[model samples]
Target: MVKEYILLIIGAVLVNNFVLSRILGICPFLGVSKRLDTAMGMGAAVIFVMTLSGFVTSWCDKYILVRYNLEYLRTIFFILVIAGLVQVVEVLLKRFSSTLYSALGIYLPLITTNCAVLGSAIICATEEEFMGRIFKSTVFCFASAVGFALALVLFSSVRERLELSKIPRSFQGPAIALVTAGILAMAFTGFAGLGS
Candidate 1:
């Protein structure tokens, strides 16, 4: 059981990264890749939202969706939950960490539609192992968020360097960034063999 949960965590984090393997949240990839600092901020915000939303969504799925035959409303319900949660988090952040909230506030609103967060919730809620395993679900969400942050930070750093480096006119900016992300994905694939 321990090994199985560990594999789930590893699988979500690297072997099946939200950004790399899953191809979610490309909007942020391109939009937030200009600076490492902003990327880090966005990543932190995502991690917080995804982790908390995952736990809530999982509980809803198990107790509400499954119990009430509301499975068909999964997408609608989960996305609403995520969006609502983000709003609450944003307000809390504003009240507490004004500076940090300023850094994340702009992105927090955008995270409502971030496919990666929704995907993590849906994946964790629906997975056989995570369905009933509350702890495992929480861990999986946290792992996925960490993987996203890692991928975003690396991409941002590479993009920063790419900006300074000379490149072919045809393969600059977005094109080069896409290629870089592909390479990052390939590298992360190596983690598949670990924790198994």
Candidate 2:
């Protein structure tokens, strides 16, 4: 059981990273990744929202939706939950970290439609990969968020360096970021079999 969860974590975090591998949540992955602090903040928000939604959606699937044969409603339900969660995060951030809240700009609220949050919930709620392993599914979602944070932080660190370096006018911003993200994704693919 322990080894199973470990593999699950490894698969989610390193092999099938939500950002790098599945390529979900690219908005925050790119928008908030310009600075490490912002990256960390965005990561924390995603982690909280993803993990909580994963667990709740799993329960709803097992206890409510599937039981009642309402699986078709999963997408709408999941979005509602994630959007509500983002609102909570927004309120807390505004009350406590005004600077961080403003720094996130529209991207913070944009987490509502972020494919990653919805994808994580859907993966937990329906994916055959998780099946009946509810706890592991939730953990996997949480780890996916962590993996996103890890990649974002690392990318931001590198991009920070790139900013200091002189680059040609054409490849200065998003161009370089995309190229760097592609290379990082390739590096992570090398770990595909590690969980096995």
Candidate 3:
């Protein structure tokens, strides 16, 4: 059981990374990654939202959707849960850390639509291995969120350094960033079989 959980964490965080491997939440992965502090903030927000939503959505799936045979409503239900969670995060961030909140700006609100959060909830609720198991589902969600943070932080670090590097004018902005992201994604592919 312990080994199983470890593998699950490894799988989600490395092999099936939401940002790097699955390419789910490219919006913030790119937008908020311009600065290390903002990237860290976004990663923390995503971790909070995804983990809580996984817990809530897992229970909702088991006690509400699956119990009522309303699996068809999973997507809509999950979105509502995720959106609500994002709002909570936004409020807290606004109240406690105005600087970080302002840094996040539009990207903070965009967490509502971040497929990574939604995808984590949906996966927790639907995956046979996690269905009806709130703890396991939450663990998976947390692991996936950590993966997102890891990718975001690494990318942001690289981008920060890129700010000082001299590069061809043609590849100075988004062009170079996209190329770096591709390289990062390819590097992640090396972990593909580790969890298995």
Candidate that would win on lDDT: 3
Give the residue spans of candidate 3 off by over 4 A. Answer: 88-108
Compose the digit string of candidate 3's lDDT tens values, residues 170-196.
Answer: 999999999999999999999989967
Poorly placed runs, candidate 2 (over 4 Å): 88-108
* CA displacement after TM-score superposition, residue 42 of candidate 3 (Å): 0.8
Q: What are the clash counts of all predictions, listed in order?
A: 0, 0, 0
List the candidate numbers ranked by lDDT, top first: 3, 1, 2
Q: What is the C-alpha RMSD, rounded to one decimal, of candidate 1?
A: 1.6
Q: So what's the TM-score on candidate 2?
A: 0.88
Clashing residue pairs, backbone N/CA/C < 3 A, model 1: none
For model 1, the stretches where C-alpha displacement exceeds 4 angstroms are 1-5
- lDDT for model 1: 0.86
> After superposition on all CA atoms, what RMSD does each candidate show versus the true structure?
1.6, 2.7, 2.5
lDDT by residue (63-158, candidate 2, tens digit) is 888889889998998788778877887898899989877766566676776899889888887778776667877898899989988998999998
Winning model by TM-score: 1
